[model samples]
Target: MGSIFGTDGIRGIYGDDKVNEDMAFRLGKAFVQFLKRSSDHPEVIVGRDTRISGERLQKEMARGIIVGGGRAFISPIITTPGLSYLVHANRADGGVMITASHNPPQYNGFKFFNSGGEKLSRSEETVLENLLSDTDPDRGLKIREEAVYLKEATESYVRFLLSTIPKDMDFRGIFIILDCANGATSSVASELFSRLNIVHGLINCAGDGENINRGCGALYPDSLKEYVLHLKAVAGFSFDGDGDRVVAVDERGDVIDGDQILIIASRLLKERGILKNNLVVSTIMSNMGLMDALRDMGLRHIECDVGDRNVYETMKAHGAVLGGEESGHIIFREHHVTGDGLLTSLQILFAMKYFNLPLSKMSKWMVPFPRVMLNVGVKKRPEINSVAAIRKVIEDAKKDLLNKGRVLVRYSGTEPVCRVMVEGKDRKRIDAWANKIADVIRLNLN
Candidate 1:
């Protein structure tokens, strides 16, 4: 129960190795109490993915929510982005998404979103953490038998998904293929795709509870790629387990990543005179090609740390309308408070249709710079945060690159490793420099 929240939220392998029911209940209670002082008194919506433990964990979390004097309207097997949309759209006090997101099937988690339908900020997390630390662990256990809404949550989400899209996109002749990773969005993505009059190929559309995110969804999209090529479809989009991020495979069977998606979307939006400030915000993990492409289009580019939340922060601060991480966590500021993979994919494909260009042609807005990343586990996890030796390696690499290229060193938020990254036009040079930094970190920092 101690400090389970990471830079994102609480995530772990299911059962004893990870978060337990006791912890779930406590988090629920803690979240409820933390939000009680807000304008509304804890009318938090709750939702989970299609993992095997979703139902049981849902029950436990709901109980905790009720105990905290919060009414829990629990949704069964809903996508993460839908939960965010629900939180804000319904005017709920906040939302709790019980998803492990692209983690393995055996993992589960609890994510807290504020009234704005975005993930809680660092200050909010700190409040929750402080409350957890000061409270009695056994105090909130008695309220575990309270009430919750256990049905029909997915219906509202599906209806809203169809309603929120721009009225002009009609892909009547285009074919679409979607791989939902057999997770939460299985039912909704297909229905939405079909209603739009697009010829559709849907795979991994069945979540067996045991197969979520198992090399089929956005993370490993080879199967979708193969299916798209075989069907000769225009393009295919894949969603991760929780369905908040999307990746695509073009008609030529090449996998298109989040950077490419954002590039295409920005260009299209700019042309339509809808892109605010003519700017896009991306994380440091975004390819230099993406930055260059945005720059060439006379669009300003802002970069944040390597997370969707950071991108959102930059967008909010800079008045940008679009932002995302390279992992497909796109924040369409006009549409959502956070990343919505399915929606982002929809936006991209609709733009493609508007332009009537092949995915290959539409996607080639940028020439990707060669880059290499190496992660090294450390004996003392805090060394990545504190060690001077780690700093020297990055600074030296950056100086060496000196306008010709770039290097980035960061600690993994979900693991005890320091990541070393180098980027340049030359792949060999980038890899060599990345290895050099990795060697120094391995020998001296850790």
Candidate 2:
């Protein structure tokens, strides 16, 4: 009965109170009704990752779509971005991707994208939520239309990704390591790398439905880092469960986060006169050092809230070509609408080829300041500014750091926790300050 959509979409533990077959069916019917506003019999593309629950959830959703007089096209086991690309390419009315993204396999969710390959807006999501609440479960006439399987959906997406780079481009000498997170990209990343003619080694690609994001992928890339170092490859790329986010490692086994990736790509784009307005967009979670690096390069930076949707909106507003979060959701407006991990890996390769430098050396352009982040479990999320004690502590920390660093305290949109982050030149000072703020928040909220 609560709101279904979160910052990303409707996500929760599979079989939990939040997400189940009944909820998915309702969502499918609501989505079809929403689309009926523009079209008589809308066609929707439904896809899912490698989760064990994905098959049942998607089947239930397709059933609701059919009962609501809409056609459902299923692409079994596809990435989130792949679904987006298919929606745009196939000119479908809309699309639904069943995934939990970087979450564990036990959790599953749904992401809806419009025909233009963009995520549903806040208002659109609200309309669907309202429909779900009001619609009767057994009121609609259950039509018996079998969902059509889109056998070529994955192949089409692969072709699109290959066309992004130059046809003559060859990665023969580039030995790279890829960690597919044993999720959606498990079936696609290896093929793409192979077709590109790269000497690549893959890890964590053997998914058993329950193994997705199990101490692998972007959330846990220590093993990939070590492997990259051991093999002395050019670089290593790690993708999340749904292949919309990525984290990279340099040849030296040093991790390159989204901030560094943004800096590297933006610099290259600027030199080629492809960076629109010479500007970039990032979230508040990004390191302060990125701003300093941008200033040095004579580029402008804009900060938004902590979400890829927010970053994309700001990018569109300012005509920025590149934007991303520290969590590795990098969006290149010149390419796809949503984030694509495989495409991001290609861009990194393009940068390396153009610059003719190793990722470790190119990443040196930005020196990240020491950052400390702490999460405090909370019973409820009250406004941080309304708490006198929390506000005073934040103000004091900001004053102490002054121009040397920054402090940010915000509540998580998905979890019941308050995140406190402090960044400065001194590691010890920032760590202490971060814990101090966290303690104050816990005392007040928890």
Candidate 3:
């Protein structure tokens, strides 16, 4: 039940024994030591978001890295995308990002990257856990002292961003607003819009470590929805705490999820004749309309478990060009291996420019069906994956939802609960189906 790594990486509420400096130091030492044993003088990069404990963890981690005979470069409070950029641009041996993503302020985690700037492979993680649990610092590792060269990553990151996108993006006629989520995308999005000559406004642009995602991020799109209407902006976008996911506010202030974003991006890619194998990877959480969009264009879909990494792995397995979560961690296989919210925003903007269409019009390609989702809390979750009782409920729900709707029930990966979802053309049916499944799971799985 206890592992250092969680859904993302090493995560726990701050000031807790599980995610303290000692564990941070051990994790750092384990990585550097493992790298040294595998090669000589492995250089790496470490970056963090604007969390209060970020600085202390950075120092302790870096010391462990240097002590284990590796060079560690420090990047001050940049978005998660920025760290990925540094890993590729600087060609570091590895990278570590300190973030808990959309988790509360009191929680923090460390995400490890391999030499390729992607998440650590399962094998690598297993090795690191072994080393962390058993290794002693004083006698087993070599030591050194190195300076942390603080990097202004956004400047270079933005330029790299600009080059990947088209030259003449004229959103002048479109008034767009952006919600920075009081996290990492605060500065970059504003500057990107101005340089593109795209007329836009912004909110929650400054992040106090304590203020991040405090009622103002992708998870809280209502804030941006209100802003979109207040400013009468053409559209608005929201970035998560680490700026890896984007949620948008339409002209009508309707919140747009990644399914719609995927539909738009996939259509654009298909138009450009760059979509690989005419395929996309999405989770079961994707809207039903997305399937219709794919069907209309004769494109296929590969469904994976609900996670960006799972989607990425599916993309790699099927040789698909694109994949992402409902949240906004869209990945374009051609550009980068992992999710980049900045990249996703640019892709959407580029699509709008190419089509010379409004965000609302672009969204028309896929008509989203109503979806109902709820989390059922219980004392403890039992094995419901293949239980006959849960299977019967699923079978009955599937039969009832045939041809017009669907049902999905799974334990929450990040929380102590189970998720029930029902999607269909009818809201009442969706709600009833969702609640019925929830009731069954609560009675048995719970």
lDDT at residue 267 of model 3 (Cα atoms): 90
Which one wins by lDDT: 2 or 3? 2
Instruction: Judging by TM-score, tell me the better candidate of 2 and 3.
Output: 2
Report the lDDT tens digits of candidate 3 across residue range 298-384.
Answer: 999989887777787899999998998888889988887788887888888788789888788888888888989899986676667
**TM-score of candidate 3 relative to the true fold:** 0.93
The TM-score leader among the candidates is 2
Q: What TM-score should be assigned to candidate 2? A: 0.97
Question: TM-scores, in order shown?
Answer: 0.93, 0.97, 0.93
lDDT of each: 0.82, 0.90, 0.81
Looking at model 3, report the run of 10 residues with the lowest lDDT sum.
135-144
Candidate 2: deviation at residue 89, Å? 0.4
lDDT: worst 10-residue window of model 1: 135-144
Q: Report the error of model 2 at residue 329, Å.
A: 0.9
- The parts of candidate 1 lying over 4 Å away from their true place are 1-3, 16-18, 139-146, 383-389, 444-446
User: Candidate 1 overall Cα lDDT vs. reference?
Assistant: 0.82
TM-score of 1: 0.93
Q: What is the lDDT of residue 57 in candidate 3?
A: 83
